[model samples]
Target chain A: MSHSSPASSEISFVQHHDDGTFKKTVRKVTIILSVVTIIELLCGLAIFKLGHGSHMAVLMIKGLVTILSLAKAFYITSYFMHLGDEIRNFIMTIIVPLLLFVWFIAAFLIDGSSWRELKNTAAGSKPATEQVEKAVAPGDKK
Target chain B: MSSAAIPAGTKWWSGGKSPFNLSYGKMMMWYFLMSDAFTFGAFLIAYGTTRFSANYWPDPNHVFDSAPFIHGGAPLVFVSIMTFILIVSSVTMVLAVHEGHNMNRKGVEKYMLWTILGGLAFLGCQAWEWTHLLTGDNPVLVNGEIVEMATTVKVNPWGEVVPGMMHNGHQVTTPGPVAFGGFFFGITGFHGFHVLSGVVINIIMYIKTRLGHFDQRGHYEMIEKAGLYWHFVDLVWVFVFLCFYLI
Candidate 1:
C-alpha cells in the first residue's frame, strides 16, 4: 500500500509546492476566464444594441457566450478542479458521461423542430396574447 | 523501513489509504463533484437546447436588465457585486485550504465562516432575483411582442425587443409561452439549489471545526473536501453566467 501511494509528502491532485506551478496555473486561467467573461458581456450588450432584432445576431451572441463558457469549464476541470493531473482512466470516466450529456442535448435540440411545427399548427397560429385575454374575459363572465 | 499498513476492510485501491485519510476525503470530494458536475451540465445543456430551438428567444440583456435602484440611482449593480462576492469566496476558500495545510484551526474557521457568509449572500441574491422575475414580469416580451400580461410595463433596453425597458424584456400585457417560464425556473432554480446545498455543507463543517473535530484528528481533510465542493460551485457558476447572463 505504501509503495502504491505516491509518497507520504507527495502531492497527488496538485503539484504546487513541489515545483510551485499549480498556483500559477490557477491564476493564469482565472485571469483568462475573467477576460473572456468580460468580452462575452460586451458582446452580449453589443448584440442587443446593434443587432436590432436580427435573429442571426441573436444566434451569434448565443454561440459566442457558449464558447466562452466552455473555455472556462475546461480550465476549471483541468486546473481548479484538478482533473488535468488525474489518471487517463479517471479522466475518461468523467469524459464519458459528459459526452453522453452532449449527445442528449443534441437529441433534444433536434426534437425541438417539433416546436416549429407546432408553431405553424392551427392551434399555435393564434398569438399567445389573444388566447390568454380571451380565456380571462370568458372567466370574468362568471 | 516498514511499509504502511492498509486499514482493514478497505479495498486495495481505496487509495491504499484509510477511508478517513486526507486522500480518501479528496477522492470522495471528487465523486461528489462529479455528480454535481452532471447536474449543472444537464441544466446548461437543457438551457442551450431551449434557447436554440425557440423561435424567438429574448435577448439575455433584455431577460436580465440592469435598472436604477433607489440608492444613488444604482441600476442593476447587484449582479456585478454578486460576481465579485463569489470570486472573493473562492479566494477565501484557497486561504482556508492553505491554513488546513498548516493545521491552523482558527484560520480555517475564520475563512470558512467568510466563505459560508458569501454563499449565503449569493443565495439571498438569487432568491431576490427569482422573486423579481416572478412578480415583476407577467407577460415578458419574447420577440417584438409581449407574451404575458403584467400590471406594469417591462422594457428591453438593449434593443432586444425594443430599447429602454426592463431586463427580462418589456413586460407586455400578454401571456408568455409557458415553456419559457418552465425552462427559466428549472435551470436557474436547479443551480440555486446546488448553491443552497453547498452552503449547508459548509455550515456543518464550520460547526464541526468550531468544535475542534479536525484538530483532534490531526488532519483537515474536511476542509479540503469543502474546498473541492466550493471550487465546484464556482466552476458551475462560470457556466451559468455564460448561459443565462452572457448568452
Candidate 2:
C-alpha cells in the first residue's frame, strides 16, 4: 500500500492504476459522436427533400449543418486531442484563433453580399424590351 | 546523499524542469498539434464561407452516390464506413499507447501495426474517393440541366481545376465552377494529407518498437506522442466527413 516504492520489473512502466474507467469514458464519447453524426445526416437528407430550391430553407439548413459540424469538431478536439486534460488557458488558446477566424469569415460574407447587391442593382434596371429595341434599331439603320 | 534532491538540468522553454516529465520530442509534438489545429480551422472556416456564398450547392446524397452494383445510391453509407474506419483506427492507436505504457512490447507492436494498417487503409479509401470525385463517377448538375459533368482546374486556394479535367453525362465542361472542386479538394485533401503523414509516423514507431527503442527508455512517451498525432488525424477526418459528406 506504500506509494513511495517503485516497481523494479521491466513491465512496470505504466503507473499501477486501473484504466477501466478511462476506457469507459472513451467508449461513451465514441457512442455520443456516432449518434450525433447519424442525426446530422438524417437532418441533411430531410432538409434537401423538404426545402429544395427554397433559398431561405437552404440558408437555414446550411446554418444548422455548419453548427452541428462545429459541435462534432469541438467534441473530437476536446476529448480525442486530450485537450480536456490540458490547462484551461491552452483550451482558450485553441478557441481564440477560431473566434478570430469567425471574424474573418464575417468580413468576407459582408463583402460578398454587398458585391452581389451591387451587381444585381447594376443589371436590375435594364429592360429586355428596350435593350432589344435599341439593338434592332441600330441593326436596321445599318 | 540523495540523487533525487539534486536539481535537474532544465530546458529553456520548460524552465529547466520537465513538466509532466515529458521529453523535448513530446513537447514539440504538442505545439505541432496546436499549430496544425489552427491550419485545419482556417480550412474549415473557409469552406463554410464558400458554402454560404454559393447560390446552390449540391446535396451530399446527390454528390456521393457511387455504388458499383446498387440502385438509389446514397452518401451516408460509404462515408459512414469511412468514418467507422477512422474511428476504429483511433481506438487502435490508443490501445497501442496503453500497451506501450504497460511495457508490453508485443502488445505495443501488435496494436501499433494494426494502427498503421488502419491508417494505410484509410488513405487508400480516400485516394479512391478522390479519383471517383475528380473523374466524375458521381453526378453533378451544371447550369440547371441534369447534364453530364465536367471539371477543369483553374486558379484557386488549393489548386485550379482546368477545363476538361473531367467529363460526365456527355457534357464537355470546363472546371465546373471555382468553388466546386476548390472546397472539395481543400478540405478532404488536407485531411488525406494528414492521414498519409500519420501512416508514415506510425510505421516508424512500429519499426522502432520492433527494434526495442521504447523498452530501453523505460517509458513509451514516444508512443503517447504518436497517439496524440494519430488522434488528431482521426479527429480532423470527423470534421471533414461532416462538412463534405453530411453537412
Candidate 3:
C-alpha cells in the first residue's frame, strides 16, 4: 500500500496486453460464432426432416450439432471470457475441475438406462435375456 | 513495471505479487463462473438421463414448431432469433470490455446500453414462449377421452398423435412424459433468471461508466468483470439452445 508509482506498477502486472490484433481477433471470433450457429441450425433442420424412423441419421446429425455447439462454446470462453489470454496455471484452475463433468454425465446416463431395464424386468413385460437382444437398437423396438 | 526487472531466480510464489498475474476480483470471478458451469451441467445431465430412460420423448422439432405470430409451423426459426440475439449481445459485451481497456468511457457506455437491450430482448422472447406454452390449448386423449391440455409441469400435450383421433379440428394425441415439461421449465427458468441478473449487473456497470467511476479509478476492470458474467450467460444459452431447441 505504501509503494509509490502504483499506476506504473499496476499497469505492467496486467495480463491481457494489447498485441495490436485485439479488435481483429474479436471480429474473427464473432464471425466464427455466427457461422458455427448457422451450421448447427442447419443440422437441426436436417434432423427434423429425417424423422424418427431414420433414427441413425437423426442421431448422427445431433452428434454433429453437439460438436458444433462445443466449438461455439470454445470461442465464447477463450475469446469473450478472455480465458485464453490468462496465465496457463489460471486456465488449468478453471479447466481441471471441469473434467469431472465427463464422469458425471456418463454415470448418470448409464444408471438411467439400467433403471429402465430394472423396471422392465420387474414388470415381467419382457424377460431380461430377451431385452439384451432387443436392446441392440431402440429404433427397431420403436 | 518491476515484472521485467525480476531476476531469473526470483521465486514467484515467495513474493506479494500474484503468481497468476491477475487481480483478485478477476480470479474470484473466474472461479465463480466455473462453479456456475457445474450447476448448469448438472441440470442438463439430469435432463438427459430422464430423456434416456423414457421410451418416447417428445421431439423438439414437433414441440417447438410455432413462432410468435406465425400460427402454424416454423420449426427452429424463433429460437434461432433468440440465439442470434444472445450472440450479438455477447459481441457487444466484449466490445464494451475492449473499450474499457482503452479507458474510453463513451464507448463503454454505448456498448453497455446495447448489451442491456439485448438481454432484455431475450427475456422478452422467453416470456412469450412460456406464456404460449402455458395457455395454448391442444386436445389430447387421456385414458380414452378427449381433453384440452396445455404444456405444464404435471402435463404434456405433445405426445405422439393417435391414429384416427381428431378433436375440435386438432389432431388428438396421447399424453407425453410428465418429466418433459418439468425439465423444460426448470432448466429454462433458471437460465432466464441468470439473464435477468446479468442485465442488472450490466446496468450497474453502465451507471459506473456514466459516473466516471472507472475513469477516476484509472481502469475499467469492473466492466470487464461484468462482461465476463454477461458472456457466461450467453455461453449457457448456447448449450440450452442445443439441448432444448436444436436436439
Candidate 4:
C-alpha cells in the first residue's frame, strides 16, 4: 500500500517523472514526423509534376516514395506507439513476424503473375480452336 | 514438502506480473495489432499483384487529381492533407499518453480532445474524397463515351473496357476494372472502419476522463491502451496512403 516502495513505483503509470523532459520529447517527435511526411508529399508531387521522367525514372521515384513512407511508419510506430521504449525481445516479437509476412506477399505475387500468363494463353487458344471447328462441322451447314 | 517445486531461482518462466515489463492488456493489444497488420497486408498484396498482372493500370496521379476548393488537376493534394491530419492526430495521442504517465488528468483530457478532433477531421476528408471519386468523371477514355467511374464490385472505371459482356445486351466492362475497384474499396473501407471505431473509443475515453474515472482508479493505463490503438490506425493509414494515392 506504500507508494514509496519499489514495487508500487513500478506500477505507476508515469515513467519519466520530469515533466519538462516528457514534453520536450513529445514535441521533438511531432516535429520529426511532420517533416518526414512533408518530404514524402514533395517526392510524390515531383514524380508527376516533372512529367513522368522516363519509365525507369518513374519507377525509381515510386520506390523512393515507398521508402519515405516506410520511414514515416517507423517513426509513428516507435515514438508514437512507444515501441521504442519497450524491451528488445518485445520489439522483435512484433517485427520478425511482419518481415515474414512481407516475404509471404512477395512469393504469392510471383505465383499470381504466372497464373495470369497461363490464363491469357489458354483463353487465346480456346477461341481459335472453336472458330476452326465451326468451319468443319456438318451441322454448321444447316 | 514443495520447496524444490517452487523453483530455486527466478527462471524466465517465473509466474508474476508483466514478465516482459508490459501490462497484460498492452501485450494483448500488440498481439491483436500484429494479426490485424496481416489482414491489411493481404489486401495490399492483392492489389499489388492485380496491378502487376494488368496490361494497363490507371496512373495514380491522373486518377486522384482532384482537390477540394482548388479545381483543375492537382494530383494527390487532398490525400496529402489527409495524411498530415492523421499524423498530427497521432502526435496528440502520444502526448496524451505522456500526460497520462504523469497523472495529469487535465493534460490527458486536453490532448485527447485534440486527438479526437483530428480523427473526425480526417474522416471528413475521406468522405469528401470518396464523394469526388464516385461522382467525378472517369479519367479513362473508352470509345468516345464518357463513362462515370465509381467504386463498384462489378465494374472498374480504372481498367480497360471489357467487350461482349453485357447487362441488357450492352457490353458492360473490362476484366481489369473489377480487381482495381474491388481492392480499392476493400482496403480503404476496412481502414475507414478502423478509424470510425477508433473515434468511438476515443470519445468513450474522453468522457470517462472528464468524469474522473482514472483518478478514482489511481492509474491511466486505459488512456495508454487507447493511445496504442489510435497510433496503430495512423500507422495503417501510412500504408493505405502509399497503396492508393502515391503509388
- The most accurate candidate by DockQ is 3
Summarize candidate 3's per-residue lDDT along A16-93 as a digit string, tens digits: 446357788888999999999899989988988888779888888888998898888888998888888766777889
Show model 3 residue runs off by greater than 4 Å.
Answer: A1-12, A16-20, A122-142, B1-10
Top candidate (lDDT): 3
Clashes of 2: 14
Clashing pairs in 3: none
lDDT of 3 by residue, B1-247 (tens): 1123333564567656667767778788999999999999999999998888877889888888888887656789989999999999999999888888777788899999999999999999999899989997899897888889999999999898899878877889998999999999999999999999999999999998999998788778888889899999999999999999988
List TM-score (chain A only) for every prediction.
0.69, 0.67, 0.74, 0.66
TM-score, chain B, model 3, is 0.95
Return the TM-score for candidate 4, rounded to 2 decimals: 0.82
What does candidate 1 score on TM? 0.72
Q: Tell me the DockQ of each model, to 2 decimals.
A: 0.17, 0.15, 0.29, 0.26
Q: What is the TM-score of chain B alone in each candidate?
A: 0.75, 0.78, 0.95, 0.85
Better of 1 and 4 by DockQ: 4
In Å, residue B204's CA in model 4 sits off its true spot by: 0.6
Model 3, docking class: acceptable
* Cα shift from native, residue B7, model 4 (Å): 21
User: Residue B45 in model 1: shift from native, Å?
Assistant: 3.7
* TM-score per candidate: 0.72, 0.74, 0.90, 0.82
lDDT, model 4:
0.75
C-alpha lDDT of all candidate models, in order:
0.64, 0.65, 0.85, 0.75
Residue A66, model 1, lDDT = 79
Task: Estimate, for each residue in B1-247, the C-alpha lDDT of model 4 and write its tens digit.
Answer: 0011222343444455444556678888999999998998888887888876755776677668778886647887888889889988988898887777767889889999999999999999988877776765443335754455565665656565455444433334432456766787788889999999999999999999999998787777888889988999999998998888877
